[model samples]
Structure formats: C-alpha cells, structure tokens
Target: MKYNFDEINNRLGTYCTQWDYIEDRFGEKDLLPFSISDTDFKIPKPISKTIQKVSQSELYGYTRWNHEDFKGSIAQFYKRRHDCEMNLDWIVYSPSVMYSVSLLIRLLSKPKDKVVTLNPMYDSFFTVIQDNDRQLESHYLQAQNGTYEINFSLLEKQLKDATIFLLCSPHNPTGRIWTYEEMEKIISICKKYGVKIISDEIHMDIKLKENKHIPLLSFLDIYDELYTASSCSKTFNVPGLIGSYAILPNSQVKDEFLHMTRKVDFLNSPSIFGMYATMVGYTECDDYIDQMNDYIRKNMEYVQQFLFENLPDFHFSMPDGTYLGWIDARNVPFTSEQIQDAFVHVGKVAIMKGETYGKAGEKYLRLNCGCPKAKLEDGLQRMKKAMDWLYNNQKGGGPKE
Candidate 1:
C-alpha cells in the first residue's frame, strides 16, 4: 500500500505515444487512447532510483551481455516467483522478446515454410512471419460465452504441415492462461510432427489467480521442442527500456540462434539502462508485483461494473491475466470500422480495433485498463455516449444537430 496507484502523473510533454500522439495516430485531437498495452502508471520506485543512480555516474559504455548479475537475477526471479528452476546457461540476452522471436523464426524455419499460430494472437506475429518471407497460418480459438478454448483436432492438423508454432502464454486480447493439459496437448502434437515451438511468456508475471501462469520452460523435461522469450518490460511497465532474454534448453538450437544473432550482429551489445532496470526489477522489486496485481484487479472490476451498468449490450469476460479487457460488441449491428469511428470521432476515445488481432476479433474492442480510476471512468463515459448516439441515430430517436 506504500506505492500509490491512484495518482495521475502528467505525461503530455514527454513524447509519450499513449498521450501526446493520439491525434497523429487516431486522427483526433481530443481522443483519449486506451489501446496500447503499456500501463499509464509510474514504474516502481526502485527501478527509477537504480536508473538514476546509474545515469548520474554518466558511464554509458557498451554493456556486456554476459554479465552474471543479469542472468542470476533472472534465474532467481523465476525460482522465487514461479517456482521454476532455470540454469544460467539456458539464458541469452536479447534487445526485446519480439526481436528474439523474429530471429527464432528465421533460425528454425526456412523461407516459405508455414508457421502456425492461434487467431487473435499478438498482432506482431503476423508482421514477423510475413516480413521474414514465411507463410502465416492460423486456427481460430473457439469462444463460448466469452471464454476461449483451443480446437486440438484442428491444431494437430495444422501441425502436420507446420514448421513452427508461435504461442502466446496468458494470451493477448483474450488473456486466457493456458492450462497444463492444454499445453501438454500442444507439446505432444508439435513433437509428433517435428514442429518447433516458440512460446512468448512476457505476461507470465501478471496474473489474477494463483498458479495460473504455467511457465512453458517448466515443460522442458517432457518436451525438448520448445523455446521461450520473456522480459521485465511488461512486468515493470518499462517497454521503452528495450531488453529481453531467451531461454533455450537444447544446445543445438541455442547455438543456431546465437549463430544467427552473431552473423547479423543483432543483439550484440546490451542496453545500458535496460540492463540495470532488469537486474533491479528482478532483484529488488519483488513485492512491487503483488501491489501491482491488487491495483490491476481493482481496475478490472471498475471496467466490468461500468460495462454492466451503462453498456449492457456489450459483453466482456474478466481476464484471468494481463491488464487488457477484450470486449465483444458484435451485437451492436455495426462493422468494426464503424465502431472504431464511433470510438474515435463520436466518443473522443480510442481503443484497439479487433481486426488488428485477426478475423476472429472482428466487432471486438481491446481496452487497456491499466490507468487511473478517474481516467478509466472518463473513457467509460465517452464510450457510453458513443454507444447511445449509435443506438439513437440508427433508430431515428437521436436529436438532430
């Protein structure tokens, strides 16, 4: 309770994409953005203090990627928080999880090889696959009353021809934490068909329930066809820090990733401040996560209540993990573009259009609820106004301007 989550910090002049570039990004001058994944709250005090102390020394030299403190801190964090044991040798530094995923795709598969993933996944995976000249294939996750389930039969069929499977643990947009049984089936299917597995566990630390986040690395004993990329960025609200690490247990695959990395000179040196931030986050900010989870739970409750009371036509399930709220607005009788326009032009608020995730996400909106309660309330009011306008204008009941 020592850290205050209710206070709103001014982010206007800092060139923050969330606050300052709303007009440029969404084509509106007064729209409030609830789209991006990063939180509006300030980071833990320890992180800022560490960075400040390091920066005051002004020793911005090239940071070594093989530092023991960095690896040890990450290892100990996994042990303490997730009860997962990880050897320091299994870890390798990268600029970011996305960067590591791109390299892994290239290393594990060739051009034109099909990479399969679940629909409504992290949007970046589509770009990474296409930009690397690989075929992007997806199977939709079945939604029943707002919860999502995987179609194992279709997944197995896809794995028959797939070269790699990209998985989002505590999945984005939907925020369903994959259970052990589900992960086991996925691993078995991939193992049967010789498909390499790449798991993105960046949001593993942010969960609502106990034992919800089953670390993919913990399954290494049963399945060796796995690789994981995670970071402290999402955990500590420091995406701009630009640092992540990859866990590859297989020696050959690890060497291949390293070879590709060195050939292109990708991730050759570490970020000076990013390294400090990661070390401090893992070592000194353990209790900070517990506090963050409590604040996030309250934010989630606020959104749920606001939608139930004011926008009953919209349906959203409370996510088991992550700070995002996936709202199903299919009953609104409008296309995704129309709904987005309403959110932008009518409501003066911005949220992520569902189509960005994939076809399955059409007519849906992803709301980032990681902001102050007052700001979230304002956004809810704006959305209600837009929805009211839509209903009245369509029914010939709204006031004419």
Candidate 2:
C-alpha cells in the first residue's frame, strides 16, 4: 500500500508530548511543535494492522516472552538490516532505554562512581546518572567545518577509572553517526580502564543518505564489556508501548543486570499489542522504513537549502542520521533563552533549546524535521519571518539584548 506522507494530521488534543503539551512546555499556545524527536507521520501500515489483529484476541492475561514471537523477530531484524547475528539468549526485554541504562549504572558501579557520555546528547543520559547516584562526566564534540568530531584525547582522560560509558549512536541533537575508528578508540579506552560500555542504538534505523549505523556490539572482538540497548519504538513510533531490549553477550554482565532488576521486580509486562506491532515491524516493514527515510532526507535537504539561501546567519550540519537538524543560532544575536522565547512567542515554532542538552549546546537548537513537507516549510517560513523582524527591530543596526 502506498502511504501519503503529505497529509497533515492533527495531533492537538491527542495527548502528544510534542503537540498537546507545547503550550505548557514553551509557555505559548500558538507555537508549532518541532521540539520532540518523534515524527509527525502516521504509524506504518504493517504495524497498525498487526495491532488491530492482536486486539481481536479475547484474552489479555499474564504475558510471557514468546520465544519465537519476540526474540526470533528481533534476531531476524538485526540479521537482515544490520548484518549482525544475535542469539536469543542475548536479548533481555526492558520497559525503555533509560530504564535499561539506570539498571546498568546500578549494577556496574558503586554510588558516586563516574559515568561518562558525550555532551549535547539526549538529556535522559544525564538524568539516569543523577537518578542512579552516579557521577556524570561529559566530553563535548568539537565542530569543525559544519561537522562534529569527538575529542578522543579528552574522552580518554575522562574514561580513566570511570565505571560506565553511555554511548549514543547517531547522537542526539548533533546527529552524528560515530565512525568505526571512533568506536574502536572508545572500545579500547573502556577496555584499558576496565569500564563497561552501555550503547543506546535506538535511532540506529534512521540513517541518512550514504551513512550506515554500526552497532557497538559489532566490535565485541575488541571489547566484551559492552551492552547494547535498542528498540523498535523509535523507528516504529510506538514509544508509549514501552518495549525495549538490552543485548548482552557477556554472561557475567548479563547476570549483574538481571540481579539489579530482580531486586526491584522490574519485570512489567509489555502492552498486548506492542508484541504484535514489534513482530510485524521487524518481520515485514522494510519498504515502509525505506520510504520514511526517503521522506526525511527530502525534508533535510529542503531545510539545509532554506537556511543557506534565506537564514545565512544560522549555521547547521546536515545530519548523518535521524530526522533531527542541529542548528547553530549564535549569529542570530540572542541568548539561548531569548532565542527559544522568540521561536515560541513570535515565530510560533517550538524547538529544543540547546542549553537543555548541555552547556556545549548553548548556541544551538535541535529541530525535528520528521513531518509533512508543508509543515516543515511553514516552520521555516515562520522562523525566517521571526529573524527578519528581530533584525529590523534591533537598535544601532545590531540584535537587541
């Protein structure tokens, strides 16, 4: 079936974090929500159909992980898409990626032990560290010539004696797909320091043109102390279902994680339809995923061109993966809060403030481009108007304070 991504669907009053809560978050009801990472596109047909099929069943009893229905689907997905072989025993179901990260921190480190991550990443990584009572260490990615690069030297220094390294592939906000060489270096450093690596590959399937996602576990030969967390929720737009998995190869690390969860009785049964949707998504939604990627790439190209031609004062990097566009808005002559306020109040476009990610993100804002083309165009036009208005109103031919 052909999907029409051009149709604009109303998410307002739907309890959507991006839509329904925009006013509460940005303090403006008129704001267009481009803040959250989720896409505005409708769920894939295959997944929706599977959910409908499953709902026809009368029984919704105590759920057990169906070996063939659950694990088999994931193994097939990795084998087909990532070219990585995953054994059934290696997969451990968890509610979400953040939950898995918290569990790993509690299991692998004592209180106040340092947990390292790249800055300008997903905010949840920092939250996990603080919630688990672990010390947080961050290494900011240095941007050069419109691309972000990891500072290996600083990373190595931070990795010393750190108990865990939380990695974000196709990193949030910046949208970089870490090169294999970079991954190898990270793996080597963690190995030298005897630190365990917990990699979040939730956005693995959202690769842009010419970019490939390399799972951290694929480097198991170099380091066996790695745990990979992934989910179809990001790809399939079903995070509310709360189904995710941690892929662990080392039995020792696996046992540690299980013990931590067991102490808290963390085994919550997944949504009844979540199982069906995940199975169908992995088994039969290749074409849907490809089409979604194509749509997102088109939007990315449009945004890049629009910024270059009209909003030249802003700098942005073409994302290597994911539908997010990280823009450097320092030239716009406003503080991060001021820019965020303008976007919300004047531009009526809700975007993530850079400062929320980390101090390194102060001059940046992350824009979600996973929407209909018309919505994206509308957002850019609004932003252009807002900037023009700000520039015109500035005193002494410069931006106002």
Candidate 3:
C-alpha cells in the first residue's frame, strides 16, 4: 500500500499540544511549531478505519486487556519486525508508558532510593522519579562528533548506589540507538550491581536507514531483571488513545509487578478504542512505518543540509531513529532563552529549548521533522530568518535582550 506521508494535516482548532498550545505555553501566537515529539502526519488509514469502526459501535464499555487479539498483535509485531519474541503471558497493558514507569519505580524501590539514567534525557523521566519521591541520578552520555554514547565507567559508578536504572533505548532528543555491544555492557553492569532496568523503547519503530532498534528483551535470557515498556502511541501516532504495555518474563518479578499494578489501581482498565487501535496498529501498518521512516530520514537530511548551508551557526546531527532533531545553538551569539525568543518573536517559529531536558542540553533545542517536506522547509526558512536576525543584531550593535 502506498502511504501518503507527504500529506499535510492542519491541526489548528484540534487542541494539539504541538500546534494549538504553543501560543498559550510560549506566549507567542501564529508561530510555526516544531517542538513536541508528536508527528504532524496522519495515522495509518487502516488503523484509523479500525478506530472508526469501533467508534460506530456506540457500545464503549469496560474492556479486558488480556484478550488474545491484543497480546497476539503485540507479540507478532515484536517477533516479526524486530526478531524478538514476547510471550503473550508476559504482557501487561497500561494507560501509558510513563504511567508504567512511574508505577515501576514505586514498585521496584523505596522513596529516596536512587533512580539513575542518562542526562539530556526525556524530561518526564526526571519528573516521574521526583514525583514518586525517588532521588534522580544522571550518568551523562558523551557527545562524540554530534552523536551520543554512554560513559559506562560513570554509569557503573552511579549504578553502584542506584536501585533502578531507567533507560531510553534509541534515546530521546539525541536519538542514539545503542549498539549490541553497548547494551551488553549496560546489562552486565546493571546485573553486577543488582540494579533493576526499566527500558523505554517507545520509539523502536522509527528506525532510520542502517539502524535497527534492538529490544532489551533480546538480552532477557542473560538478564531477568530487565522490564520493557513500549506502545503503538509513537509508532502509529495515537498517543491520545492512552495505550501502552510492559513486557516481562513469567517470573516472580512479573507476579509482583502485576500485583502492584492492581493494588495501586494504576492502569486498572483499558480504553475501548485504544485497545482496538493498538491491536490494529501492531498487526497492520508495517508498510506505513517504513514509509514514515523514509520520509523522516529525508527531512533530517534536508534540515542538516539547510542548516549547514543557510544557518551555519546552528549545529545538528542526523538522528538514527525518531523524528526529532537535537540541534546545538551554542555557536549562535545568543543564550538559549534568547534563541528561543528570537525564533518566536523574530522568525515566528516555536521549538523546544534544550534546558527542559536538563543541564546537559544547555544550548540545544529539539526540532520535530515528522511533517511534510513543505512544512519542514518552511520551518527551516523560519529558523534561517531567526539566525539572520541574530547575526544582524550582532553585527550592527548588540543582541537584543
């Protein structure tokens, strides 16, 4: 099936966080937004069709998450796409992966227990840990030639004191997919320290060329403490559906985890449409994913070339997976806040500042390139305009405060 990935979907009036909430959040109206991780493209037609069919039933009611269809679809997707098999019995449905992470942290450790992860991570990981009263520790990933790698020595030291290690595979913001060798080292270190691993592989399906998403489950044989959370929300662009799942082997840990999920009333029930959408998304939409990855790869390349040629002060690395581009703006003669203000006020564009990710993201900003080529080009042009304004300000007198 030919997927129309280039189709532009106007999200105005849709209450989209990426599009509609920009003005309210940033105090700038009519600005082009490339901030959030959500894609501007439409979900797969087959998945949408399934959602519509479910909606037409008008019988939305209590639904069970342990059905064969849901489990089978998830199992087949992992086994077929990534060459990893997840037994249906090991799957547990959750409202969202973030919720699962929060609950997992609560179940796995006591308050004030250290939760370690990489710096320049998804902000929500920090939020979840702090919200649950856990001490958050970061092992910074070294940026080598614009790409990122784990500083395993630092990680090992941190893991010695930590109780849980939260990992973002095919990491967020920078989008560095850990190699098998890297994964082995991480697993070995965590195993040595007896720190439980919570792997978030939500962006696993967004692989670019020559890069494959390796599920943490592939190492499950060697390490049983690893728990993985993933969802169709990212792959199928259905986050609003509020569906995600965790994969665990049939063991005592799985038993404890499931028991805690019920005891705490976390993700007690499943969404009626969310369940159907997830099943359909995992079973179908394989080709759509391929086409989406290709389009996003082109967008990444286009923005990389555009920034190099037009906005030379901006530094960006091509991501291995995901639609987000982590850009370094330290060379630009402006603070991160000033750069953000210039983009909104001068260039009429809105993007995520690096500060939100942590101190490691000081002069960086994350840009979403999942939209059509025209929109991506327009955003690049706006970025160029912003850079030009900064340049003119620098040359004429001084940068505007």
Candidate 4:
C-alpha cells in the first residue's frame, strides 16, 4: 500500500481529541484511548496537497458552496461511486452533517412532534433530538446471532404518529449496513404513515464488504419526502475540515433549509479550505477509499482474533462497515460500570461505555479500530489487562490457564 497503516505516529500535546482531550470525555488522562471516531491514518495525499496549494496563495475569503464546483463534486461522486442520480439544485451546503440534521428536524417537523429512530444508535442523535425539543420514539433494532435487525412491527407503531424518521445507514455503533429489503420495509411503513425520511449516510462510503450502499436518495421515486445528509469526511478522514452537504429534494424544503442556514445563521458561505478539501476528496481520491477499507478490515480482524483468544467473554462480530468494533460483554461476570471503571482506572485505557449510546447498548462496549495496527495491538492489550484485573480481583483471584 502507498500509505503507511502500520506506522505509530505520536499525537500527544497536539490538542488531538482522541489523544489529548481524553479528560473531557473519560474524566481521566494518560490512558490509551480507543474512544473517538477519527482515525490515526493520514488523509489521502491529493486532499492534503490541494489544501497546501490553496494555503500557499495566502488568500482567505468567504465563498459560496451552492455552485457547481462544490455541489458538482458531491453530485459526480455519488453518480460515479454509488450509481445514484443527484440533482445539482437539490444540493445544499452545511458546516457538518449533524448541523444539517438538526436544521432538517426543525424544518421538516414541529416542536414536540415525534421523531422515530432505531435506539442504541449514534450518540449524537440523542443530543440532537432531545435538545431540539422533539419527542423521541425509539423503535430499537433487535440483536440476533451476532447481528441486528430493525423491529418493523414496533417501527410501524412508532411511525404511525411520527412526523420524521431519522436513519443511519451502515449504522454507527452496531455497523449494520441496511440491505435493500430492510430499507424497503422502513420506507413502506413510513409511506403508509405519511412520515418524512431523513437519512444520515455519512458512513456510506466506508464500505467493508461487496454490498454497495443503496443511498436513501435512490428511493426518491418511492418516497419524495426523503433527504440524505452525507460527506466524504468519514471516507477520507477529514471531519476536522468542517464540511458536509444535504440532499433535500422535496417541495420548498430546500428553500426553507437555506433560509435557516443563510438568513438566520449566516452560514451561507463555507470555509474555503474545507470546501476545496471535500471537492478534491470526492474527485481525486477514489483509490484511497479502497486502501482504507483494506487496512481497517485487517485491524478489525486483529481485534477479533485477539479478543477471542484473550477475552473470550467479550462477544464481537466483524461489523459490516465503519471502523468501530461493537463488543457484547453481557456474558462477562462484571457489570458495565464495573468494567468501565476497570477499562479507565485499572486498565488505564479508554473505551466508550456502551450505555452512552442508549439503554440497549448498556451490555456492550464500542472500540474505535481506525488506527495503526501497532496502536490497535496496544489498545487491545490494555483492554485485556482491564478484563484480567476484573477477573482476578472481583472473582477472588480465579485461576486461569
């Protein structure tokens, strides 16, 4: 591979969120962190080169992102990569995907209107929904045989009065890429109930398998009120760039959205560097996507094998997508809080406590595998030590092989 996925680069003292800001999230410092979602790999050369070239010009200015160069990059990307027809006029820019989601929730529905989504979902969804004064109706995905499936029967009930349905494709936390049949079921129910659909496809480009993501926009023919919030940020590891876009192709919805961003918030212009970075990422960096998947897949395999051999009580499956490893420690003798204390204070390694996602996630733990294999090996060892400490101390010095 042209990129070095094995090099151990130090990120300390650089104000890096995963390494330097552990205290903010975990309330402790100096522990090995597998906490945040970003990766340790360097971004594709094309993106960095473009940013550097632009910086050399020494010109900074407010810029519009509604034009073809910005939106066209996104449209062309989806057309070439995902085989979806994206209209240039339907495209609108936002500083981030969640920003779009928060605005769409307001524009598409009213305060106190019910927003239905799968529980144990991405953590930010909880904050985004509740903070917006929207009532949340969780139609949780059922876990079975090392995978999760949406509970459609309960979903229909939840959507019956719901004004919006927020979806996470190639879902975060659990990492199950929605199949066509599953999506069809979701769409059919929403259609019957006249519910609007808003999908966050940020993880769509992080494909770890042969199945291509059927973009929510692809179902525009079946449901016109559909919208998708996505970015090349996750695919290219450029979330710090502060760029994302939304496909709001419904009647007057785009106009209302622009009013919110342009009129109310003065977010009419995007960061020039971030917009350029996104354009180059979609246009010139296709190869990096495949290489990244290959490296992440290997890291995931390493985590699986190491856990099976060393921490058998931790049940994990190779997620269909994303760099996150969701492990079920329900069978472990210790409670979630016990294991969390062990992971932080005892093992001195920070792994995300599953309960943060939702109550359904309480029995699980999420590990960020988007790092160099050497780093991943070290983090896994820390996890093992945490578990070993739990066993030795909690079980009165239980014997082991």
**Cα lDDT, all candidates:** 0.86, 0.83, 0.86, 0.88
> Predictions ranked by TM-score, top down?
4, 3, 1, 2
Tell me the TM-score of each prediction against the true structure.
0.96, 0.95, 0.96, 0.97
Model 4, range 1-401, lDDT digits (tens) per residue? 28777877788987899999998988888989898888888888999988999899998877778788998999899999889997899999899999999999999888999998888889999989999999988877789999998878888888999999999997989988898898888898999999999999998877776666889988888988899998878888788888899998874999999988988998878888889988998999888888888989888888889989999999988889999999999999988878888888777899998898997898899999888888888888888887888887895533222
Candidate 2 C-alpha lDDT tens digits along 12-71: 878889998887768777688898888888888988877776677777886766477798
Best-matching candidate per lDDT: 4
lDDT of 1 by residue, 83-137 (tens): 8898898899888899989988988999999999989988998999999999999
Clashing pairs in 2: none
Candidate 2: RMSD to truth: 2.2
Q: Report the lDDT tens digits of candidate 3 across residue range 1-401.
A: 88887888899999899888888767977889888788888889998888888889898888898888998999999999999987889998888898888878887899999999988999998899998999999887787898887888888988998899999988998888888899999999999989899999999999875768889999988888889988998888899988899887847667777777677575558898788888888887899998999889989999989999998888887989988899988887778877876788788888889888988888998998888999988988888887788777764443354
Off by over 4 Å in 1: 395-401
Cα miss at 131, model 2 (Å)? 2.0
Q: What ranges in model 4 sit over 4 Å off?
A: 395-401
Query: Could you tell me how far off, in angstroms, the CA of residue 355 lies in candidate 4 after the best superposition?
Result: 0.3
Predicted model with the maximum TM-score: 4
| Worst 10 contiguous positions by lDDT, candidate 4 | 392-401
How far residue 398's Cα lies from its native spot in candidate 4, in Å, is 16
